[model samples]
Target: MASTTVADGIVDRLIDWDVARVFGYAGDGVDPILAALRRKEDRIELVTARHEEMAAFMATGNAKYGGGPGVCLATQGPGAIHLLQGLYDAKLDRRPVVALVGQVVSTALGSGYQQEVDLHTLFKDVCAQYLQVAASPQQLPHVLDNAFRTALATSSPVCVIVPHDVQQAQAPEPGQQEHGIVVSSTAYARPRTIPDVDDLESAADLLCAGRRVAILVGQGAAGAEGPLREIAERLGAGITTSLLGKPLLDESLPYHCGVMGHLGTTASADLMAGCDTLLIVGSNDPWTEYYPAPGQAKAVQVDVAARNIGTKFPVDVALVGDAVSTLNALVPLLPAQAGWRPEVERSVTAWREVAGQRVAQRPSRLNPQLVVHELSEHLPADAQVAVDVGSVTYWYARFLRLPPGVPAHLSSTLASMGSAMPYGIAAKLLHPDRPVVALAGDGAMQMNGLSELITVADRWRGWADPRFVVLVLNNGDLAEVSWEQREMEGDPRFPTSQAVPSFPYAAYADLLGLRGLRVEDPARVGPVWAEALAADRPVVVEAVVDPDVPLLPPRQPEQKVRQTLRALEREAEGGQAHELLRAQRAHEEAR
Candidate 1:
């Protein structure tokens, strides 16, 4: 016999599913659920944040860090509205999180009650599953169970909205016999296959004949770091990474050029254009306008998903299977061609010296570079990190560095903000013991609502309050660029180029009962960072970073196209130490 209170049914189901945490602050709409938890304090503890937005973000961080479904609750109206950005993030990043929202009451469904907004309708686009617990007695537990199971099974976000009246009533028994969800792998998964001796021989024959060759990698190519390096060493070809695969192979490598995307390097694209053949592995990177205008170079792609073979751009050869295994077979074929390495090595070394230095120049504070540096050092190999869009993304490829095996979550198609929190919640929920962090911009955090910070602290389980450490770079703005706009180009005023007003980050953090540390001085960064780490609880380090810091490109032009590119990618094709003085003069025209 369960307790008759509506809160009991909700809490019982959450406990049964092993939900140890719930994000969001207590309020008028969801007070029943909070009060019920007070009676059953032995089962779950509530994390209270000052802002509803923090609750969702904290939940998102926990979800990514934990590797399961994270739960967050918020009041109706603005509170529920605040959780939207984080919810959207969980959906695209493929992290699972369950959102518990409060509603005014069933009786006032259409009467336009205070803080009355249709959360179901707003959530339709982002939630993997959404359910409203309007009717009481028999439907409450069933709806709660469905929301929980759906979030866990799909590795996506789900929403469960409980109306005020129904939440106080007795919950009816669960409709289903077993509380479980089902999942299956899609048929589109990449098949495993070994490259035959004949195929390798054919590939080697082509490579041996080509004067210039390049290798392009994607996220799917992550684990093949060793194999990728081996191939580059043997061939002496330029190594260009996709946005998803930048950190795996540092551009400092002799052959490394840059990340390939619309916002990627012109020199990388230039070198790629000069290539006779391009080797692609493990990713179907959607943005290809960076490669060339098409019909420019021959290409070969290999991946686990076979459909990605000819999907993005035209390819001369498409191999379907595991990239690592396929590359392993291809290595023997590469060593067979001995003469090409010398020619390729010469060009690779030259580009590295000039490009690496120019791109490395960046501000040490809150700019994208600093964001990358702080996160790289703070996020352990075992730790999980969730990224939000905007200037934060520039930091992703330009600054933050991750070692092998670290999972960095990002948006798939829609590069939207407000997603870091939900993804973080889902990570922490699933991977409880892991340290979860949300890398967000101030604007993104605010646009989503500020009350959910409390929800992250409460992660719902007994005594363990898993922390959702937020490293927020408050530049206070939004930034975007499409190829058409980058080309149509009136003014390249990246939103970050504009100035913004100050917000009360610390005051709000303290209000939420969260440890808030504000760093106004660059010199204080080291000590404050140590304090946050030492606190070992939910904390927000509001670092005021410069908005104008440039995202340094990993590739630069040779003493050639200085005018056409920014300082970083403006060097020539040899590894010789360039005379900075003369190099500037050579391309003074392009500038």
Candidate 2:
């Protein structure tokens, strides 16, 4: 009988789960596991990332794009610690991920040995389930199985920590099985949570009673677009989406009012304010101030998690179920009403006119809005977009129109920077037939780590019909932070917000052997994007945009206006005085 090592057992279990890939860095603490991974290279491929954080981001992206539990591995201490940011991104986004951490030898633990730390306590908050110091070889299979199972079942991250010595121990012979040891045989599946008939009837009654109804959606309503559309058409409702739910429906639909919140559209904000009844589906949007005021409207909420049903606002009827099932059951109970459709259509038309003018406005440098809008026009109908957080997010949220069936991923909940590139790579890896683009800002690209672009370049040769593209809005500063400081604190631009050096990102892409294009003229933005999209390999397009363009909110708060006025007065004697005065005038005139 052949005896296998605990590390081998763990790898075998991963194979059983059909997880053929892992992203991580190899280090001394994880040598045994690395060796096992090498032996199984034909069956499972290891993607070595430039940083552990990038590995975690890649894993999270994999889970999101592929619809399975993403796997990442890292060594003890610093390596494990580096995975937190990406792990938190996965946790907050509610994606399934499994992180395998290597620990110090069992004997060396608590003896101040090198690379030893209490990983369980470190990961307690981020992980839905955590396991540390697997005592014996027999426990390896169970630990691996449980990690994958918990991650998939809860749609959250799970961590399994293995000691170096424990992983090297020999497993029991094939016939000598331990009693009471049961390895999980559960497959990765998410059963729909349907609401009870009473709950559905109650929600339908509340919705039917209102004169004007509006539907608000989030990422959890991903596959229920048809049902949602049917219900909205029946009730003559306007549809507004949270930032994460922007791609859930066709943006070109007449009743679609676009995103709602700070980065939302004027039409969406207006529709939500005027509605008599609001039906929220699968969104826990935290911006309470943007929602309809309490007692102003009757609210109905549908969510898989019972705790989230009424947490965002007071609900008249709470239907606790999956978005598709609940929407399907409630559509028949409502009567057809044509009262609200015309009002919503008019608002949407007016908002689109204003947006069209903004997109056509020519600045001294390229307009970020035009770049995103033009990209949207040229994008394939089924393209997938991953947007990084920053001013770039404003352009994407406001201008990029995704048709139904086109998926989009963003770091909305955690609102992290530098996630676009990793997400693009993962999306491309999983769906090689579709076009994937990462929209990022210059500062965010540098902060989150752009070296991962090389990972995409390295793997591009193996991909079928690879169409990965990275579009960078290189404005040479942290534009979003600068605008926030001026709007919130009445402060003039400082060194920290205005001192990012412009790097040759397109040239860097060329050095990595990926197709690269740089556009400084506004006229060239569309042409360059077209060329990048047509490239056979991974490509990057860097467009120089104006840093002076302010990202104004949909509706500027009074306090924000006052702060801007104070900031303009303070900068009266500075070099930007004339520019600031012009912006202030334009802002006032727009309102």
Candidate 3:
């Protein structure tokens, strides 16, 4: 029998923790660990990504969608450096991810060896929860155990840097519990948490006192849907979700005001503005201006993390506990009523009409809104969505109506581009039987998504379900930033900065041995989506959408509108875009 090495020990700990896969790109620095993984291939799979950054993203996505601490590995120096973007994504989004990075040999600690880096210092900020360097073979088990535990307990990224020499060293024997040895077991269980009874009562009292209440939820309120609905029904409250929270509740509910923020709907704006009392459930959405003006609404916040309470909005009562536990306890205290329901329903109804009008616009080119809106009709009940950050995010936020329980995730707080491809891949890997749709803008596709497409092609044949669809909004402009410049700075769309070089995304997909469908005409939008969703293999539907379709924020004030119009007037195609903006704003005002 082969004696267990420290690398083998690391893999053993991963198996003990039930980590099914580890995503990474190989390098000489991690050769020992890679060999160990290859030997244990039957127990735990290694997912090779095109880039280390993408691997980290896959890990982060796994954590977000799979509810486990995602594990990623990388070699020393550049490979470790490449993992930062995805690590930061995990950090900002507060997802549990354990990153195993290789370091230089233990003896070369001070010597500037080839591919050597100060891995601890580099990972310190992103993995602030825990960072450990294993110099001795005896320390491997404890360090790996602590990395997993800290990641799971804190719901944030952690790092374990193993020197090359340490990985090749002999592992501690089963009975080796000597004086200098620290043996640690691999196990962690989430504690059932609840706020104090008095705090729950205080929150209940605040909700009861309000005539019109609005419940704003974020990702933290994920499992509390049942109790959340019950409390909303009792308080006669309207429900609105932050972009991250959009998938937590059923949008089909009459009083559900889609999403709240710049990318949100008019009904959500009204829900935030009209409410006298607010119940913020596990939401730390940063759009403070969109929230009810500081003193307008009395608020109660429930969050698992105490640090998040009163950080975004002023709170009358803070219930630091699991959302489900807190909301369940507060439900009985709320008075049953239906007075605020009708008004909320009316707002939802009006917003639907506005959304319909916006998507129905028959522009000369394909309207981007129509590109995503058409998917709502054919979206599968079991599908998972991965959305990139850009104008595509706006369309997804406003138009796509996700079926109840269909999870859609994006780089929300970090607002990172090129996240959709890796995120979608991770989601699909977790549930091979379920289909996945990734939405991306031209700029985002070019950033890192195009390269990750090769990964999709490489793995699709192995998946139980082959219906992985990538929707690329192929407008030759960085539309989101262009609009932001006009809206925020009153600057005209700068062609040099905004223009994205044209690329035939559909053609590239076809070359990669996947089904490719191109849609430039407004007429083919629905049919193409239908074809892609039903394809036998992975498909890329490249929609040549109009770049000028304004990313107009909900309830835009007169001054901002004027600024946007002034910026538009200086552009070549301003007339058409100006008309589209006017029409969209008219829909909101008329609502």
Candidate 4:
């Protein structure tokens, strides 16, 4: 009988779970696993990443795009530490992923080992399950199975730490008796929860009583798009989305109000404020102020997680079930109400017109909104977008209208910078035939490991089709933080937020053997985008934008305005009157 090492057993289990790829960097601690992977290279491919953080991000992206648990591997200590940011991104976003971490040899675990760290304690907050595989080889298969199962069942990351010595130990023989050694393929089941008949009736009654109804969607409502649209139409309701749920429905729908919250649309805010009944479906929008004030509107919430129901607001009726199933059940019981449809249509039209004006205005420097607007117009029907966190996210969220079926990936809950590029890479690897674009800010593009661009070039060089584009809004500063300083803190642009050295990102792309285009003129935006999109290789389009352009929220609170005015008064007294005047001009331009 052939004997297999624990590393080989782990690899075999991953293959059985249908994991076609793993992302990571090499290190001494993981050499045995690497050797086992090399032997099984034909079955599972390894994607070498420039940074361990990017590797974790790539795995998260894969889970987001591939509709399964993303897998990543990292070595002991520092390598594993670098994965925390990306792992946290997955945990917060509710993406299923499995991270395999290497550890020091079992005997040297607490002997002041060079690369030993208490990984369980370190990863406690970021993972749903943190397990260290036992030294015995017989324990490998059970640990691997549990790790994958927990990740999928909970829709969160799971970490399995393997000591270097354990990885090299021989597995039990094929015929050996073990308690949990069943090798047959087992299906990972997630049974859908259906709401009780009484609960559905109560929810329907609430909707029927209110004349003006509004629906709020989130990530949990992804598969329920058709059902949501149907229910919204049947009830003559206006629909708005949480930031993460923006792409659940096409924005071009007549009754669809864009996004709601700090980065929301005026129409959506107005719709939510005026509605007599609010139906929140599968969203846990943390911004309490954005929802209808307590006692202002009755609410009915539907969510699969029982804990999430009524967590954000007071729900008169709570339906606990899968969104698609619950929505379908509730729709049949709702009464058609056309009385509120016309008002919603009028509000949506007016909102779009005002939004159009903002995107149309030409500044002294190229406007970031216009760039996103043009990209939206030029993209293919099936194009996928990966948006970074910053001011650029504001434009993408507002300007880009994702048609139904086109996926848009973002670090929404975590709100992390530098996710765009890695997301784009993973999306392209999953759907090489489709067009993928990463919309990012200059600061975010630099922070989250821009060196991964070389990884893209190297991986896709020989591919038959590679259509990935990174569009950097190069404003030469952390524009979002600068805006926050002025708006939230009532402070002038301080050195901490203002000084970011401009780098030629396009030139850097060129050095990495990918197509690169630089656009300083607004007139060249369309042409450059066209050229870059048509390229057979991965491309970078760096569009220079005005740093002075302020990112104003759709609806500014009255208190915020008062604070800004008071800050301006303070600045005027400090012999910085010119700065106050500049702030006023920028605010006017944004409006």
Question: How well does each candidate superpose onto the true structure, as a TM-score?
Answer: 0.65, 0.95, 0.98, 0.94
Question: Candidate 2's residue-wise lDDT over 468-490, tens digit each?
Answer: 88988998878888777778778
- Index of the highest-TM-score prediction: 3
Off by over 4 Å in 1: 1-7, 36-45, 111-116, 128-155, 164-166, 173-258, 262-286, 296-311, 314-356, 359-388, 410-413, 417-488, 492-497, 502-591
Best by lDDT: 3
Please give the RMSD of candidate 4 to the true structure: 2.9
Clash count, one per candidate: 83, 0, 0, 0
**Candidate 1, 185-242: lDDT as tens digits:** 2112223566666666676666656557788888667668888888877766777777
Off by over 4 Å in 2: 1-3, 174-180, 572-591
Better of 1 and 4 by lDDT: 4
lDDT, candidate 4, residue 190?
A: 88
Over 1-591, each residue of candidate 3 has an lDDT whose tens digit, in order, gives 434899998998899899999999999889999999999999999999999999999999999997498999999999999999999999999999999999999888879989878888899999999999998887878888899999999989999999999999987776467898887887678888899998888887788889999999999999999999998888889999999999999898999999999999999999999999999998999999999997999999999999999998899999999998888888888889774899999999999999999999877679999999999999999999999999999999989999999999999999999899999999999999999999999899999999999999999999999999999998899999999999999999999999999898999999999988999998898899999999999999999888888899999999999999999999888888899999989998998
TM-score leaderboard ranking: 3, 2, 4, 1
Find the number of clashing residue pairs for candidate 4: 0
Error of 2 at 390 (Å): 0.7
Error of 3 at 40 (Å): 0.4
**Looking at model 1, which ten-residue stretch has the lowest summed lDDT?**
181-190
Scored by Cα lDDT, where does model 3 land?
A: 0.92
| Local accuracy of candidate 4 as per-residue lDDT tens digits, 467-530 | 7889999988887886677678988667555667779899998999888898988788889889
lDDT of 1: 0.63
